[model samples]
Target: MNFKQLGLSDDLIKILNKSGIADPTPIQKQSIPQIIDGKDVIAEAATGTGKTLAFLLPLLENINPKSNEIQALILTPTRELAIQITNEANKLKEFNDISILPVYGGKDIASQLKKLNNNIHLIIATPGRLLDHLERKTIDLSKLKTFILDEADQMLLMGFKNEVESIISKMPRKKQILCFSATIDSSVKKLAYRYMKNPIEVFIKQNDIALDAIEQDIVETTDRKKRDALCKVLDEDNPFMAIIFCRTKRRVDELEAVLHTRKYNCEKLHSDIPQNKRERIMKSFRNAEIQYLIATDVAARGLDINGITHIYNYDIPESVESYIHRIGRTGRAGESGYTCMFIDPKNIKDVNEIEDVIGFKIRRRNVEI
Candidate 1:
């Protein structure tokens, strides 16, 4: 069904229509009406299922613009996620002068403190920074009517359970709680039950959308020779655009430095980088100005850039789903793409698990550098 039929406000509908977003995804279709009606919800959704807008569009529709209090608060696990959600909220601000702020580290505190006085109606924030604001009494959540935990599973995985609980305690207990996560483990369920009031659960399971148009390969290399293997693949493939996924921020930084020394057009993206620089790097990558982008899994969530021809898994993720997300960055809009994963000895089990899900043994290639 269309977003208009999902019970969104007319203004939001017009905005979405103008942006060429006519139909709603399964998560959006299920979650939007409930969220708009102020019901608690727990949505089991993946990153690419348009989950961001599922909560965002309804939240915006239900926001009371006349109230100065921070009517809605969205807590995220990482700085990049906070910024990404806020960027999305900003795009819908044309309706009734809605004020939304992104509260995260690496930005000026004084500037944010000043903006806090404007009475931001909605805040997309990381748990730590939002807690900082709470402790300093610079922002008040007492009037918050809706609390959304985006990527709830990631927050728990990042060890932000205490911070998330503390933030939730500060908000009104009767407020609507919406939790969206890729996986609904026991931890996420506990969090939902503790704060939410009999939340309505919605699950959206998307098949392997990337497997059709993408060629997958496994490159066998030791950890020491992984860099050389990556270089050899880049030289041979010479992709128009590529994203190299690392498991952590340190790995991204280290890989970017190595690729730079080897005279490759590359940049590193992680939560530690300044917000402005990250935006610039993403812009450059989207414009095809950068040949490769090295990023962590958290940093690359919600990234939807077309023309990505190749994906490189420099450090294999432990889970099968992360493997899918990393490679799914390519092969968009019916465009053919390629993914090369560099696996060391210890990563054999991880690759085996991933192969089992994909239902085929990926073609193995030897890298001699």
Candidate 2:
């Protein structure tokens, strides 16, 4: 369906067309009308399914353009997601004059404070920094018409439950609440039950073709031969750009050093790296300045890059959901991609769980020693 059929304003539809987004994704098509009608909504969709525009379009349509107060608040799980959403918002409002600000850690608070003092119509923030603003009394949300919890599960996983609840408490009770996530776990459901006013629930079934587009394979390797196995795959596949997922920050650092010694153009991303450096690395990766990005899950979360030819699982993620999230980096926008996993004997059980979740068994390939 198109944006106009979803009841979006002509200006916003024109903006979307200019951005080359003529048709709405399933989530956007289903949830946009509900949101524009001022109904509270809880939407479940996977990563890279265009959830950002699903909520942002309606938000732009619903807000009073003339009101100077902060009318909408969007809380994201990480600084990258916050900035990404803010950028999308800016693009949609290019022809319009609605003011939007993205507030997150790793930036100067004074600058954010100055922006807040100005007439801001929408604020996208990380939970912790938003709380800091609240504590300093530097921003006001009394007139907030809509509150959004983007990536609700990730926020709770990062131990921001209390901070999120506290921030929500500061918003007006009459405002609409929208919770969007890849999965509706217990914590997210609890939050909805406690706070939302009989929200309409929308669940977009996972696109089977997108999952099928990813050619997944596993290589059994001993702990000592894992690096050799990784090199063998890279030698054969020669991906345009690939992201290697390590289970820990230390592993990422170690792998990056080894790759550099082997003369591979690569960079590492994890919580230990400074936020500014992380952003630079992400930018470089997106521009294909770097051929490989070695990262931990936290650093890779909410990354919305395209043309990823392959995803390497150097370490099997701890959860089935995490494995799905890791592989989802590729095969986006109906493009075919590959996922190659290096599994040691110890983590074989994790692979089993992943297979169960995906409802198919991954083909095993012999690692060239």
Candidate 3:
């Protein structure tokens, strides 16, 4: 249905039309009604399915402009996600004139503290930073009406259970809670059972690798041949943007150095870099200023971007789910993409598991070095 038919304000509808969001996505169509009606919801939808806007729009539509205190709080798993959510929230300028702030670690807390005095309608934050604000009394959640946990599964994976629990305990008892995820891990399910009140569960089809619009292949190789093989593939494909997934920080560093030595526009992302640098790296990558990004799983998890042409698994992932998550970087928003995995003889089972979940065999590409 049209956004106008969804009971959205005229101003919001106009904004959506201008932004080319005329029709609501399935999740939006289903959940917006419940969210606007002030219901706790447990929605399971994959990435790029408009989960952010699904929740943000209703929150913006239901905001109490009369109140100066924080009214809605969104807890995300990563700093990048927190920033992305806050950016999207700012696009609701047609609906309200309230502040939307993003709070996360590795940035200056003083700046965020300065923003606390404003009329913030929505606060999108990471768990650790939110708990910090709660402890310092810098954030007033007593008037909170809606609380959202975006990417609940990712948060649980990052070991934020205690912090998330503490943050939840501080919110008002009468608030409407919403939790959205790609996959509802057991911890997330348990959290919903404990905190949500008669929540409506909405599960869309999980995004599998085979169902994605990405072509997959494996390059069987030895450790010494992997670098040369990757270089050959890069020369052949000449991708506009690509991410090379390494298994360790050393590998990421070495790969970056080697690519730099070869004059490839590349950068490294890992836990070792400070947050500011990471932000800059991502900004460059998003703007197409950098063509290649080398990263580990921890750094690359939850990265949401568009127009990624290729994803190279420099090392085979031990967890089968990770293979899905990695290739998921490409073939987004119904666009066709490609993924190449460098596999050793011993890692055949890992590749097989990925194929089993995706329900298809990845075509093999042989490159004799």
Candidate 4:
């Protein structure tokens, strides 16, 4: 249905039409009305399912344009997601006078402090940085009207549970809470039970974890031959754009170096890189200026790029959930995609676990490396 039917304001409807967002996704259709009605909601939706807009649209609707205080707080697991949400909010608020500030680590805290000192209406932040501000009294969430925990599962996975709880403890008591996550584990449920007041549950079951459009396959190779096997797969597939998932920063650096020396247009993303460079790399990758991006799991989450034709698992992820998230990057927006995993003999157990989680066997293929 349309945004107007979702109880959004006329101005927001006009803005969404101009931005080419005429209809809402399943999650948006289910959760936006409840959220706009000022109810706590717990949503279980996968990545790339238009969830950002699901919470963002209702958030913009509830915001008071006349208030100079921070009326809304959005806590994300990564700086990338905070920035992405902030960018989306800025785009939607182009015709309005609302001010938003994204607070995350790896950037200039002084500049963020200056912005915080201004009449910011919404603050999209990571838990740690928000705690820092709360401790320093740079941010006053006493006036916060709405609180959102985007990617709650990711936050818990990243060891921010205590920090998130602490941040939540500092918000106004009577404010509305909205939580959106890819999966609702026991911990997520406990968090919701503890914080949310009679929350509405919304689950959008799409493909049951693995996208049907993704062609999943595995290439068995030894540790020494994985690089050559990956090269062979790349040559055979000839993807328009791809992300090569490595397990560590060192591996990403080494792999990116090797790929660059081989005259491949590629870049590396990891925690060691500066935030500005990482943002630039993400922008380049989104624009298809870079064909290959070698990244670790921490660096890859919250990447909402479209048109990714391939995903290369240069290293098997540590968990089944991570594998799902990595492959979910591709096969988005109804486009057919491919995922090739170079599995060493040692990580066969991990692959098996992934297969068990996805409830299917991945096609195994041999490449002459």
Candidate 5:
């Protein structure tokens, strides 16, 4: 279904059309109606499923542009996501005329304070920085109309349970709440039920998490020779754009260093990288200025840019969910893509688990190093 059928404003629709986004995604189709009708919604959608627009459309459409007080507050797990959401919001800002601000650490607080004084309608912020504003009374939430928890599972995983609960407590008792998560476990459900009233649940299951458009292969190699195997694959298939998934920040760093010596345009992303630098790197990667982005799972959330044609598992993931999550980055929006996993001998069971979930065996691509 198109966004117009979903009852979006002409201004929003026009903006989306110019950007070649005419249809509403599965998550958008289910959640938009309930959200626009002013219902609290709990949506089970993955990062690549357009979960951001599911909330953004209704949130922006419902916002009274004339109101000066904060109407909507979106809490994210990391500053990068807050910035990403703000970027998405800004794309439609010209039609909406709504002032959107992102509040996070590492950014100049004084600049944020200056923007906070303006007629801001939406505040996309992280929990810790938002809590700091709450405690200092620098931000007001008493008149909040809509509260959104983006990446609910990620927030709680990052140990923001108490902080999230405290932030919710400070909001008005009668406000619309929206929760979007990759996997809605009990904790996310508990948080939603505690604050929302008879919320509608939009569970959009991705039956084909294996992603048919993305070609998959297993590169049999030892841990010590995995880098050589990866280089062989890179030289053989020069991808348009790719995300190289590593298990840890150290792996990402080491991989970046290795690629740099090989003269590959690459960057590393992890929590330790300053938020500003991470945002810059993300911008560069999205613009295709960087050929490869080596990042851990946590840092790679919300990085759903188009044109990502390949995903490389430099480090094999331990779970089916993570395996799908990594590959899902590519083959997005119905585009053909490719993925290769560097599987050491000991990690065969991990491959088996993923194969069991996807109901097929991944083709093996051998590279003798």
Candidate 6:
């Protein structure tokens, strides 16, 4: 359905139209009107399904621009997602003139403090970083009308429950709560039960049949032969953009160096790098300046890059969830993509778990190097 039919104002509908978004996504179709009515919602959608804009639009539309207090609080799992959400919010507020701020770790607190003094209306923040500001009384949440948890699963994975609980305790009880996630487990359900009040649960089952447009396969090799097999696949496929997932920071560093020596424009991402450098690397990768981004699970979560033609799992993930999250990066926007896992002999059990979770057999493609 068109966005205008979903109860969005002419200003936001005009912005969306100019931004090339004529139709509302499934989640937006269901949640926008409910959010406009000031109700709690729990939306389940995959990456690249425009969940950010779905919630951001409603939040912006509901904001009382005259109030200087924080009207909406969007809690994201990572710094990248926080920044991205804040940027989307900024786009919709061209006519409203809302002051949106993104707060996360690895940035200057003094600067955040300076921005907070300017009548902040919306804050897209990571839990720990937002908690820091709350502790220092740097942010005022008394006028909060809405609270959103973006990527709820990842926040729990990052062990931010205490921070989330603490922040919620300080908020006004009458606020609307919205939770969005790619995949929800029992723990996430429990979080919804405790925090949200009778939220309308909306699920977009994209991943079940989502990647019919993409090709998925596995590359089988022993530990000694895995590197050679991956090299052979790269030579054969020659994808325009690929992200190689390594299991550890050291492994990512080593693999990035190896790819660099092989004359590939590759970048490394882990917890070790400075925030500014990480931002630069991601910016370059998104702009196609870098061909590959070798990263650990922590570093790769909540990324919103499109047009990734391939994802090479240099090391199989230990859990099924990680496997899903890793591969969900590619094959987006109805584009065909490929995911090849360099599976070691001992990692077959982990592969099986991934297949079991995905509820299908992952095709194994033999590489003759």
Q: Which candidate is the best by lDDT?
A: 5
Worst 10 residues of 4 by lDDT: 204-213
Off by over 4 Å in 6: 206-209, 349-361
Candidate 1 lDDT over residue span 283-330, tens digit each? 888889999999988888767677899999999876987887778778
Cα deviation of 63, candidate 1, in Å: 0.6
User: In model 4, which regions exceed 4 Å deviation?
Assistant: 206-210, 356-360
Model 3 lDDT at residue 320: 68
- Whose TM-score is greatest here? 5
Write one digit per residue (lDDT tens) for candidate 3, span 1-369.
Answer: 877777778988888788777778788888888999999999987665677888988889998877788899999888878877877778776566877889899978999899888778889899888888899999988889999998888888889889888887888888899999877878899988798899998876644333458889999998888999999888888999999999999999999999899988999998789889999999999998999999998788667787788999998875766677788788876688899999888888888888887878889997866
Cα displacement (Å) at residue 282, model 4 = 1.3
What root-mean-square deviation over C-alphas does model 3 reach? 2.1
Q: In model 3, which range of ten residues has the least summed lDDT?
A: 203-212
- Local accuracy of candidate 6 as per-residue lDDT tens digits, 1-369: 777777889999898889877887787888899999888899888776778888988888889888778899999888877877776777889997689899999999999999888988889899888989999999978778899988998789889888888989889978899999977778888987787888998888755535666677898888787777878898899888888999999998877777789887789998789888998998899899888889998888778787799988999886876676778788876777789898877888888877776768989898898
Clashes of each: 0, 0, 0, 0, 0, 0
* Shift of residue 213 alpha carbon in model 5, Å: 0.8
Give per-residue CA lDDT, model 4, range 117-159, as digits (tens): 7799999999888899999999999989999999998899889
What is the alpha-carbon lDDT of model 5 when measured against the actual structure? 0.90
Q: What is the C-alpha lDDT of each candidate?
A: 0.87, 0.88, 0.85, 0.88, 0.90, 0.84
| Candidate 5 residue lDDT tens string, 185-266 | 9999998898889999999876734388889999988998989899999989899889999999898999899999999989
Q: Could you estimate the TM-score for every candidate?
A: 0.92, 0.96, 0.93, 0.93, 0.97, 0.93
RMSD (Cα, Å) for all candidates, in order, is: 2.2, 1.5, 2.1, 2.0, 1.3, 2.0
TM-score of 3: 0.93
Root-mean-square deviation of candidate 1:
2.2
Error of 6 at 234 (Å): 1.7
Relative to the unseen true structure, what is the C-alpha lDDT of residue 263 in candidate 2, on a scale of 0 to 100? Answer: 93
